[model samples]
Target: MGYGLAVLGLLLVLSGAPAPAQTRAQTQESNDAAEQELRLPPIGSPAAEAMARYAIEREKKEYRENIERAQEVARLSAELQKAFEQRHGLFPDDLRKLERIEKLARRIRSEAGGSDGDDEGSDLPKSLEQAVRRLANVAKDLSERVEKTPRQVISASVIEKSNELIELVRLIRRLS
Candidate 1:
């Protein structure tokens, strides 16, 4: 295997290929250049430029909206965490909060045109599915907590669920 790798390296050197390592700025510059090229109007009409400007502004608006939604999700997850850590144990409001989280997740998935976790041929992305599964796991952990599990175990489970919720919200934010 070492010899094969050496041979491959030699071939790659001979081919004068550029190294794969790139700084973030370099990558961004390349991406920006590509985007600029793609935005060049085919007919070079003033109307085309106007349309491009409109599209760019619309995209900016959509991006801002998505960020707001992501913030809301994160806030909800934090609230859930606080509820889990309450001295009085799980309250009725906690269940209502969980329902809200589920609703937001479904709405996010729906916006991405994913199925509601029921259809056999669901076109949801793997990340979204994983997030949904994490949500389910959190619910299961909550049940365990409600069953009067040891304090340490319940705390640990809550921590894990909180992390999962954050990750799920992050995934939802990257939908666009």
Candidate 2:
């Protein structure tokens, strides 16, 4: 009991609280001294505050751009799905747009901060991989049809692939 009381007394002393009877003037003088001692560097110095602010702003811009890019990809996917549902052959422009969307998705997956790491850490990578695989499978299936009937490769069979693409777009939007 005595040892415990002594330890508690030592802790109280080490805590550096003011004595209970300290006068107002002494308190004010102590506060001024503490402020003077703890003064920061000059305002214009190369402080981490400025760097942190810039980094935060840059991340905000990147995140906003990522969301916009994801939305654009979703829109393109919808256009492709519509064309497929209409039973029209994919034009060169549609092919180009698909390529562009794929490129943008890859860029977002590789460069986005929260998604650059492992697949287990973020669903974006896994969804992106699945989307790419599904697209490749569709392309392969179409190419096989091209071997069998060269002119009929772009038929109603693409509707299923278009649905998969739409789901991929939804995943991308969720990521953003």
Q: For this target, which candidate reaches the highest lDDT against the unseen true structure?
A: 2
Q: Tens digits of per-residue lDDT for model 2 on 6-99?
A: 8877886788766556778998998999999887656677765786678788866765665565566656656665664465445666667676
Measured against the true structure, the TM-scores of the candidates, in listed sequence, are 0.38, 0.40
- The sequence of per-residue lDDT tens digits that candidate 1 reaches over residues 92-144 is 66556655765654443333334434223223336533444454555444334
TM-score, candidate 2, is 0.40
Clashes of 1: 0
RMSD of each: 19.0, 16.8
lDDT of each: 0.51, 0.52
Note the residue pairs that clash in candidate 1: none
Per-candidate clash tally: 0, 0
